[model samples]
Target chain A: MSALIDLFSVAAIGAGLFFFFAGTVGLLRFPDSLTRLHALSKADNLGLGLVVLGLIPRAENPLAALKLLVVWALVLLSGASTAQLIGRALRRGRK
Target chain B: MSVLPALDVGLALLVVGVAAWTIAARNLFASVVGYVAYGLLLALVWVRLYAPDVALTEAAVGGGVTGVLLVTAGKRLDALASAEVGVPPGRALKILAGALAALVAGALAWVVLTLPSPAPSLAPAAAEAAAGPGAGLGNPITAVLISYRSFDTMLEKVVLILAVLGVWSVGADAAWGAAPAPLRKVRPDGAMILLAQFLAPVGLLIGVHIFWVGADAPGGAFQGGALLAAMGMVAMMARLAEPPRIDSRKLRLALVAGPAVFLIVGVAGLALADNLFAYPQNFAKPLILFIEAFMVLSIAVALPMLVCGPPNGSPK
Candidate 1:
């Protein structure tokens, strides 16, 4: 059971890596500013979230895991709000 | 070799990719968002590298507050520029800069992987020293911040107060009633308003909890205060509370309260204890806790007010 859990954790991490790569590709290939923002928003949030989840099981204690969770939650909150603010500003500029 | 190191390498790569996109993006607004994303990813990297304290600080100050500031500034600047005008770096210049950045990244990675571990981190020693009579905390960081390094923390608070004063002196006040062009009046009964009301109190509770737990865990005054500030911002957005007038005397008092209390406490310590800002060994926890609580409240208000920008009741 422990081996299986470890394998699953490794796979989750790999999945995170995949999302991060997708974000990079999207960032480079997207034609417009807003679309690239969309790519970054989805990719980085999911990528980091998955990675943190993968690490939680390996944490030494519950407090350590809680700390990891806090970091992830803050990131998500800040990332989304910032994206909205920037996107709104861009739209306003065009008008 | 463990697979953990391989995962660390991958995380480092992600950090690099995010940094590249942040600086290279054609749109300045997109670039600011990219920077926020970069900071968040970098915090994760810190976690993977076993620096949880640094990670927490990076997540709050770097990813959270800095992101808010940049986006607010970007919005103010957007009105001055045309989006159609792209500011792409010259091709040769880009290549040269890319090579230089890559070289620096490689050097850093090499150092990180090759550096030998130092014997005995100062944490254990600090923890041992803090375990003296009347010390109530088990967490080394908290002990250091409040007891051993109390002076540093006091000075840090002073810096924060000075920052608030500087911001105020520069006429940093949010433009009242300058909602975005698409701003619609959020009904007081709307889901968003209701949600803000529910979350604001809960956020306040969590902030207090985190502040209290700092003595034993990964939370601290800065993180707690920033969270409270975030709640305050939500309240402002939902119009649950009206923005204070730029010249309001009450606003000025709250802004200065944190530092004023900190100074008073420090002076009392000098008279009662052996040194300035020194809490009687038995009173360290309560003193630190009291100061942090007030600091959190002040910071929560001061930061959002700073972002709102200038007192003339205009958005810019």
Candidate 2:
């Protein structure tokens, strides 16, 4: 059971890494500001979320797991709001 | 010998790549976003390195708080005419700098991995020693932070209060405008508003739970405080609670309450206990709990105020 959990954890972490790489590549390759934001918003939030999920089982106790959850939730909220704010500003600039 | 090291190496490379793109990006907005992404990844690196407390702080303040600040600044800057910045640094310079950074990072990583394990971490020892007499809290971090290291925590609150004062002093003239129109109208009946309302309360409850549980668990004052602040943010955005006016005495009180309470408690400790800020061993848990609860309220108000800039009046 522990081995399976560990395997699952590793897979989740790998997925996070993939998203991070994709986000970075998009940022470098994309031409427009909006597209780059798209890359960042999509990848960074999910990447961090997955990483946290992977670490959940490894947490020393329930409190640690709760902490991880708080971290994840904060990332999700801040990521989306900030991205939205940036997108609005970009549109305003275009006008 | 282990797979963890390999995973760490891979993540480090990815982080390096993202940071390079972020710093070198042509568009300022893209660069800001990249910086945020880099901070998030850096937090993950911290977690891999076995510093969960630092990871939490980095993720919240570094990734979340700083990201919002940068994005707001970028929005404000967007109105100015776009002037093309100078050419990117030469490839040779980039390579030289990159090589040097890599060398330093490599050396540091080597030192960290090679360091001999101490017989016992100060944290566990402090927890055990304090459990019998000083601050009888089972959680080492909390005991260390609010008791043994209470002076540092007191000063940190002062720094936060000073920061709020500085913001008010400088940007006192700016009006409290609604978050861009789209966000303002967030449809009274929108599903998102309903969801936020539902989630906000639950999040607050959990935050309190974490705060209460911190005495023996992984949660603590910072996480609890951040979660509480997040609830306040959700309320402010959903228009469930109006943004307080700059001149409102209530707003001022909330801003100052954490530091004032901390100082009072610290001084009281001096009178009641042998040392300054030496929380009474019997009531240490409750004392820390009260301090954390108030600190959470203060942080929630102060952080948003910082992001909102100077409050002119209630947002229309």
Give the per-residue lDDT of model 2 (tens digit) for A1-95: 99999999999989998999999999999999999999998787988889988999999999889989887886677677667776877886999
TM-score of chain A of 2: 0.96
Query: How many backbone overlaps does candidate 1 show?
Result: 3
Candidate 2, residue A72: lDDT: 82
Positional deviation of residue B198's Cα in model 1 after best superposition, in angstroms: 4.7
lDDT of 2 at B277: 75
lDDT of 1 by residue, B264-293 (tens): 887888788867767787777778778777
Q: Chain B alone: TM-score in each candidate?
A: 0.77, 0.76
- The most accurate candidate by DockQ is 2
Against the true two-chain complex, what DockQ does each candidate achieve?
Answer: 0.10, 0.11
DockQ of candidate 2 compared with the true complex: 0.11
Encode model 2's per-residue lDDT on B15-77: one tens digit a residue: 999998987898877887888888889999988887776676677777777777677657656
Top model number, lDDT = 2
* CA lDDT of each prediction against the hidden true structure: 0.73, 0.74
